[model samples]
Target: MSLVVSPSKVFRVAEVILEGGIAFAPTDTIYGLLANALDRRAVERLFAIRRPSGRPFLLLIPQEDWIEELGLIIGPRQRKLLSLGITLVIPKRTSVPLYLTRGRKSLAVRLPSSTAGFIRDLLKVVGVPLVAPSANPEGLKPATSVKEGMAYFGRRVNIYVDAGKIVGKPSTIVRLIGYRSVRLVREGNVPFREVLRFLSS
Candidate 1:
């Protein structure tokens, strides 16, 4: 049986994730299925649960520093874009496992905004980066509430951290081309034009 709890229960939530258990919780964007990024078994379980499309799952890092820790080099533009809550797909680093990236040449990553206190706290407590894909099975809409999350995952998910209805689109994703340019991939909550404007500024 899945345990449904509010975001206030951060310790319990961290316990589940640290123990290689998956959690259904609200993220900086939409609800996501979260697991320890470095735990291969845990990530395999998350893959089984999500039955995802071939595309790689985006990871959530507590801060920009984690980018290099994961073997990804962060440039100034990459830094600026991440600060705007955009997801970036950079050339893959060896540290990122093939299982997580699904054999892709690049990996998508995000540093959650400071406004996302629950996620920030959870990351700090868990003490590791997390693989966070929208909390939905392939071909289904993301759950906006714990009820919907529970309905979709049930006992498969260890905990459902309810923050409330998070009915928002996922973050905008862009591919970093070289030292200074970026190619828009998928535009989500952040507008592509705005991303361009920010880059220009």
Candidate 2:
């Protein structure tokens, strides 16, 4: 069992992930089971951990520069939402693997203002988007700490980065209905009025 002090400390974490190992780590929202979004087997392992695949995850991207690479386009409104740290469900790029979006027409992507330094650096090191679902198994609450994550995953994960207790809920999820319309799929850490205000600004 590798208990990492921070995501950056562990050279082995990225190595293991490059080799298709899943990790339990804290995110901007909660502890998440992380795997390379481009790795089919690793993603399948994440689905297996969820036992029937209940909660789909948003992809953690390091920056906006990756927009074209993923086959996604962001307009002014999306740029605003990104500034507010809201997750946007946008049209998938044709190059995106089906496993990443579960064959859905859209997928969630966010820069995650809540990540630790380690998570940020790890994203840079991995050089690929990562799928981070809440660390608990299906039907369980999202784990906010390492202890809770461990209870759910035990030794099933390759690395565990304990960031103590993380605050706040998940990011607000918005689905773009068209060029002019947006839908609130989930009201989470960010408030609805704030989202409206941001979009309007």
Error of 1 at 129 (Å): 0.9
What would the TM-score be for candidate 1 when compared with the true structure? 0.94
Model 2 worst lDDT window (10 residues): 2-11
What's model 1's overall lDDT?
Answer: 0.87
- Rate residue 164 of model 2 by lDDT: 78
Candidate 2 deviant stretches above 4 angstroms: 2-4, 7-10, 114-116
**TM-score of every candidate relative to the true structure:** 0.94, 0.88
- Evaluate residue 126 in candidate 2 and report its C-alpha lDDT on the 0 to 100 scale: 85
Off by over 4 Å in 1: 52-54
Tens digits of per-residue lDDT, candidate 1, 101-186, equal: 89887889998888887888998898889999999999988889899988899999999998988888899999998758899899
